[model samples]
Target chain A: MPAGQAVPRGPRTSRFALRPDERRSLGFILPFVLIELALVAGPLALGFYYSFFKVEYFQLTSFRGLDNYWRVITSPMVLGSIGATAIFSIVALGLTLTVGMALAVHLERDSRWNVAVRAVALVPYVISMLVGSLLLRWIFSTDAGFMAVVLGPIGLGDHSVLANPGSAMAALVFNAVWRDSAFAMIVLLAGLKSIPPSLYDAARVDGAGAFYRFRRITLPLMRLSILIAVVRLLIHFVNVLTFSLILTGGGPNGATRTTGLALYELGFVEFKLGDANALAILVFLFNLILVAFNLLLFRERRRAP
Target chain B: MTIASSPVARPWRRRARSRSAINALINLVIAAFALAPILWGLSTSLKPTQDILVYPPQIVPERPTLEHYAMLFQTGIQTPIINSVIVSVGAVLLSLGIGAIAAYAIARLPFRGKTVLIFFIVALMSIPLPSLIVPTFTFLANVHLSNSLTGLILLYSAYQIPFVVWILYSYFLSLPIELENAALIDGYSRFQTLRKVVLPLSGPGLVASGLFVVTFAWNDFVVAVAMISSGESKTLPVAIYGYLGFYGRDWGPLTAAAIISILPVIAVFVFFQRYFLTGMTSGGTKS
Candidate 1:
């Protein structure tokens, strides 16, 4: 029977009533169910299947079994990209969290100036990654670029930041921080707003200073938000491509090539379809590990009190 | 930084003055950090080629001109711009429509496996894009849907639906269930009740998710590059990449094109600032 024919039942309905509920729910959720199967699950399955076969010029050849995965894992360039991605993620996380926390605290007030400052902070978050990368390239360019113009009078104009390997990595980290810190601030600011003012008032009445109140009250309350922001930023910084791709082309002898950039090169430039697919699976596994850790933190939070 | 200064309270007047002074300085630095690159891009776009090449670069263009921007339109930039608009609008509409129905069902309908469904949606939001691009490209190629705007629209809507459901599901949860019950009792069908009652109340949520979808569809580079090979079907971001590939260090027109690509986002963001923040923060911390 159709669901409308039966009277509405409570949560403990019998097996017959339960059938109608399932049918009605399936009708409601069918669109999303179809979408996930085709777009997400299907693609992921194909990625795994493609990794086990050797393909040359878009034609699949003999089965390679574990050879593609083995080669990808042992390659020196892939190892270097993994190392670079880790360093980039850690350093970018540090800079973004520090700067974002400072901005959130400084601009937390609802005054006219503070509101305007907060609004100004979100400008970079909406701009396309391509646009942001291009803008940063122009800013740090050695030829009549802003950095060159400022550093020229100080006798430092001869060198480009992107020309040196170390500085290029630093520039990549800085660019990541610059692009994402505002988003961090938004999340952190939301956490900050949730803390009750009475807690701070109580702390102040006990002769505690601003530092004491923040250390004693604010930090503990803001831990969950910080974790969320950190996890989100880690995922983004690890996967970032446009900054390194457009600005430095992952160049200066491959110093700034992230795993994402490396994957692009493997798939597009070298046309090693099988190896690229293997690398893509590896990257997905890496992200899955991070997210699993995040879930652990979430469960721990839920179990508290 | 200011917290360190607040401990040594002198006279009230001195304390207030110092605190405000410090706040102003901090705000100035933050604003400059955010706006300086954009302003520099704008300035570079306005300068003639000679001024851009000169040493000790001028902060403001002495004689700003529109030649670079005019040159952009005088060329074939219009095609990619139109492609971007079509994809964004198409993706936003389809994702929001499909997502709304599913979200309403999840929120209101009594269902088994609902918890699992919600978990999958959240998990999908964090799935790395590069991992999927390799397989998605081959799949599209197999079906002969590659290098087409329809292909892009389909992919964008599919990828973005998780996010749309995430935002709208929360909005639906917060709405009172009694409203829906009343509508049902008044003899309105479930679909009619959603159209007449629930959707009108979720206008802010609709605008928020719509803006987010537009931004994602417009700003994507990896998916577009991997999916689109032909210039005729490329979106704005990929077109900008093409300019870099072909023009070889041409800054003037590059900056102009960059400016053009970001204008729509800036306009939408400024207008819907509150809704954007609410949607993002709620989705971030709560979900």
Candidate 2:
């Protein structure tokens, strides 16, 4: 029987009269819920459990309460990785948002040319991150790189970009922005599409200039999309490992080793499972805090106006 | 009124023309920025080894050769490509099969804890993959599924199901309930109604979600690298990563392998561009 229909007001017959529809709904969702619990939640809790233990070669030997967390907190290398990740995230996120918003605004019109340009913009994002990073690596190669050729006349051809710490980090950030700005553009473009053209028409009739209308109308309306883009990109930049691995290999004396690469090295390369798990938990908590901070910032801005 | 007759319109038209010209110039730069790297890679791939390292690198190859591509194929690039196809297609099918039903239920049925379930799925969507990689690896190893394509498929499916559900849930919600109601009134069961009525109308939604899942599975590098160790089982991205170590500064074959790895995904994206934009924007903006 369908839900919300009368049940004849009889005795508590059968003691579990789940309507047929409810039963079918339960059946439909049961497998999905089970898989999520088993795969996502179960492993997450297990990771927390593993973080407190002395794991060697993937085998948990003994429980050492808070020892792994303490070690991770005290390790200078881990701390340096966090700092590097913060720098990367900030620069990459800022560039991605600015470029994405600019592209979205310029290409918001649904013309044929706009459609084709939007597709081109997304090409890097659609390709595999490893491939994109490797392509950039080729472009930055000291010997036969595109940059070497382009900068040859300017006396910078022999300057090896990947061999320098500062430029290596910059290369990493550039790779991220090149790939992710398209994603941010897509999201922000959706926000732009939702804004009615009549708002612009009305503003023009009232003698409001383009900048004034954008500030008073578009920015206010795009707050959520901007927040979404920021949060998503921040999370991604903080945790992504491909660019560091493929483009720079965390090279130039470990200058570009982000937290994600550090975690991979800890768990897979060094076999320091306990330390990796602890660091992972810490990073996960940091992400939650970062997102919460963004939400609060946006909320405060909303309240101000 | 003619442009000559209206004095006020002249400067406005001139200004608009200048603005459009500037916009077109910016668009060209953006497009060039986007395409230059891939085009450079293609050019490098086609160039002979001697031509590749020539000073003032040739934007266009002097004598394009198929040697790099031939070398890639000779070394068995097809194995990883086939492995990637199997894993990606398997993950997409699995996620869509499982997510579609749950999404339909959440959209159409009245059930207890429905809102909580949705919140739970959304929360799952944000869990960082790095944090889960260690435990997931261990879990798969214990089950003896690590280093296997099936294991990769299962892991990818689990990772992508939340997104699939999110997109499909919005699609189902937007769909009119009357069609399902009509099916129900005709004495069809909920399952039959969903299969016969709802699923038929959700072709675009399925394609969009499936494309996203396939792309995620195909482009993934960290998980595949961590999980798979065997040569035959490695996916295309991981296999291409291996080229860095094996080729070791041989940009010709490396670029060729990279170009080959991205072809399938680029083709899929081009074909389904419209659905991709709609699905991505809608799914993201909805929640």
Candidate 3:
């Protein structure tokens, strides 16, 4: 029975028979596997399947091959939505990263006041996106809203930001940055915490200024965290729906209708399940490509270092 | 030691003082930017209907009133609030219950295809919710579970479990395995070691993962909006959205309802603020 000793074979066991540990492990993981297969994997495959056929009122009427995909690809509305999504995601990602990095650097120290400030900064993130968008919508409302009141002294009270196409898109980006910058800050702050204080001290002793220390010591060390935040925020902004839905309503002449909202309208509003599923698959692929691109960029940088 | 008394140290000390003051100022501005909309919403909710539309919007209302809050309840905001609570809590419980088991298996137990399972989970985490919405709705409808609180709970749990497993998997891996080994040597089975020894030591991990799941379930809008159509199963976000159509610029009651919807999440967040960063960064950083 000792290690490296051959055991006496009393009876041959079937190859299909699972060992005790395997059986227990299988039991432990079975429920989660079933849920994922049933809900996540199953729905994803079904959506892919539905994308190939004409679905009327949630019924598969006929196999249309790639017609649905072609229609989605060629649709002007879908093309416009993709353009809008690109603009929103790029701008929002930029602002969110900048603001989050600033906040993280400023509040990295552990103190009572800093803790309170961090909490306050995170308040917007904890609030639901729906409520946050609504709050911003109220603030930007031309009639009796906060922005109106603030701009009144400047003789711009009647000028509604949401009424203008460009500003409406800007407002959507602001809402995203307001809610998600704190998330970026939290991740980056963790990265900052992991760096040893002695490294900063050594740099300071070597006559490195603050900015120099940040460039030399912080940026390289914080690459992984920044990449993590960037990837997460990109995925979020690409897939986000509520900001456009509630804040701008894809409004001012559909200037802010993101792909997510387009998918929503196609599937729910127009009830074009086939077109929506096809678009859904397209958008999902776009998300994967975006994420993959970020990872690849980070990998390249990591290799250089 | 003599450098402390030199003139060179004076400017550095002065610079440090000014830098702290500057940091404080910047912190104030950032906090204000983060909280102004929320405070404005709260202020508007407390103002009288007429005062809400006043030209010089009162940061502090001239006549503060609870009329909006009362009206929100009168229109039956409580039903959606209750529904949200039940669904969120139920989903969190379900995700945590099964996610802990799966995470334990991946972290501690030796099993074939573990790496593949983990890869599948990570991939699932990135699947956009919009892509899954139409199909999930159809799937639930086919199974006769759509538009029900149970359906929402199940859907949310499925979406949330992958995240829960990822977080707890790292946490469990960080935990020392010697305790479980000791328990097993004391005549306990693997499941018993898991329940009695491992779980007892994983309090912080459970709390962190559970809090994340709760936030996800509570803040979700798209899935709930896609699935449920009736007022009977509406969550808080959908209900507040309904106010946009029903009230049509009635800011007072609308802000009040929005505030009501966020109260529970804010409260939980404030109480458990410490756990969130760990929960959030662990999964991302591990990758």
Chain A alone, TM-score for each of the models?
0.90, 0.88, 0.90
State the lDDT of candidate 2 residue by residue for B20-81, as single tens digits: 89988998999889988899999999999999888767889999999999988998999999
**TM-score of model number 3:** 0.92
Error of 3 at A304 (Å): 14
Isolated chain B TM-score per model: 0.93, 0.94, 0.93
Top TM-score: which candidate number?
1
lDDT at position B284, candidate 2:
27
For model 3, how does the per-residue alpha-carbon lDDT over A1-305 read when each residue is reduced to its tens digit? 36566545536478656655588899999999999899987876778888999988778999999999999989988888989999999999999999999889988989999998998999898888889999999999976567876777999877889989999999999998999898899988978888999999999889999999999999999988887788878888887788999999998888999988989999888988888888887877776775565545444543653
Question: What digit string (tens of lDDT, one per residue) describes model 3 on residues B1-287?
Answer: 47646787997778878988998898889888999999999999999888888877789988889999998888888899899899988998999999999999999988888877876676667666765787787678778888999999999898889888988888898998888889989999888887898888889889988998888778888899999999899999888888898998989988998898788888988999998876766433210
DockQ, each predicted model: 0.55, 0.54, 0.57
How good is model 1 by TM-score? 0.93
Question: Where is the poorest 10-residue window by lDDT in model 1 chain A?
Answer: A296-305
- Give the Cα lDDT of each candidate: 0.84, 0.84, 0.85
Candidate 3 — which pairs collide? none
TM-score for chain A, prediction 1: 0.90
User: Highest lDDT, which number?
Assistant: 3
RMSD of each: 3.6, 3.7, 3.6
Error of 3 at B52 (Å): 0.6
